[model samples]
Target: MFQRALICTDFTDSMYRLAQFVPSLAGGGFKSLVFFHNVSVESGREIPREDPELLEKPRQRLQALLREVPSNIDVTIDVQMGRASESILRLAKQHQSDVIFLGTPTRTMLEEKLFGSTTARLAEKTGTPLMILRPQLVSTYTTAELELRCNHLFRYLLVPYDGSDGGKTLIKKIHHQVKTNPNSVLERVRLLWVIDENVRRELLGDNPMEQAQQELDKLQSELAALNLVVNTTIVEGSPIEEILKTAEMHDVGAIAACSRSIGGILKWSAPSLTREILRGSWHPVLFFPN
Candidate 1:
């Protein structure tokens, strides 16, 4: 679905592995790729200075991964000096990237609050969809397996839906992608609805399961019109756990979701399923910012 992508790598995140898969990524329909690294300015450098020599090592380190990139795929290795969030945004805009790949290891909520998350900050600032892969998984994958994964990063999606506005927005975006890009790799989608047992019964009404099924049916038909193979499921439990469970049960490239409340004024206060999914999912998360 994505034509241009900006892939960010910190030396530890295993994002540099993507540099070795340019031909494999081309199999997934990418037209252009920018692999970026931001050399963090020293914490207490009163006099900031540009040292071309300082950046060359990381530049060559990333450059080591590329070999026989397909002629159709334009690849650029960008090493710049700045904070990561600012540098990524600038490079993304410069590249006109539709998708940005980030390697984010799962972190505790308290850790996120204390140290802060660049992914969270970037999500709030950019409209470009972010696909986060866990470094834990990326680092362990064999080269052959990673090469196979490169070709299906956007193939099948396991989407958690609960009829909320945010959920609807995600569905709409998915539809837009399929409609606008005839070459979109999104082929199958599983729409999952989980009923939270914590919610008051009165609010859920008498037939929550049946009601959810009906809504999913309508959504399935809507998506099926675009020639996607769509399926739906309903279960009872914690929304986060069940969604993760469902994702593991099926074959999917990513768990696609969106949220308006994740990063703005309501960020700290909002109890967002989107944020929860992003924090917990080991599967790659395709997040469309609101």
Candidate 2:
């Protein structure tokens, strides 16, 4: 669903490894790629000053990773000393990026609140989509494996569709994306709806399963109209667990999700399916923020 991409990496997260795979990323459909890194300003000094030298090493390291740039692809490197979130937002805008890539390790909600998460914060702040990878997974992938992964990153997406307004909005956005980019690398989409037998059984009334199938079939047609191969699933079980299980079974590249809006997401209490997926999924997540 993205073409112009802003890839942000903290060396520790292993996201910079993508710099070596520009050709693979291009194969995944990104035409313009900007790799960004932010160096935190050193503190504790009576008079703090930004150091130009701090940015040079990161720039060189990223540059060193690129062997050959494709003639059809535009690639750039940006390194600066600043707050990561602010710099990422600025660079994303400057690059006109449709997506920003980051690596976020799984952490407890308590840990997330105490330590903070740049990925989560960015979701709340930017309209640009985020592709979040697990640091542990990225750290372990062999170069060959990573390259293959980059090539198919958006080819197949596993989307959880609850048929809520937010779910409808997410589908609409996906349609818009594919409609605008006739050559969008996104070829197949799997829509999943897991009925919570415990909670939603009442809301869905006597024929929840029938109702879900009808909704999914409608969504399938909307996506299939774009010539996308669309598949739909409806099961009665835990939403998050079923979604993850289906994603793995289908070998999906990413789990595509969206919040109604940043403000609406901020108001969601604990144990939201979206939040749980964001926190627990080892697979890459494509998050479309409002």
In terms of lDDT, the best-performing candidate is 1
lDDT of 2 at 60: 94
Q: Taking the tens digit of each residue's C-alpha lDDT, what string does model 1 give over 131-195?
A: 99999999999999999999988889998999999899999989998898877888899999999
lDDT of each: 0.89, 0.87
True lDDT of residue 286, candidate 2: 90
Listed in order, each prediction's TM-score against the native is 0.96, 0.95
- Clashing residue pairs, candidate 2? none
How displaced is residue 117 in candidate 1, in Å? 0.8
Look at candidate 1 and give me any clashing residue pairs. none
Candidate RMSDs in Å, in order, are 1.6, 1.9
Report the alpha-carbon TM-score of model 1 versus the true structure.
0.96
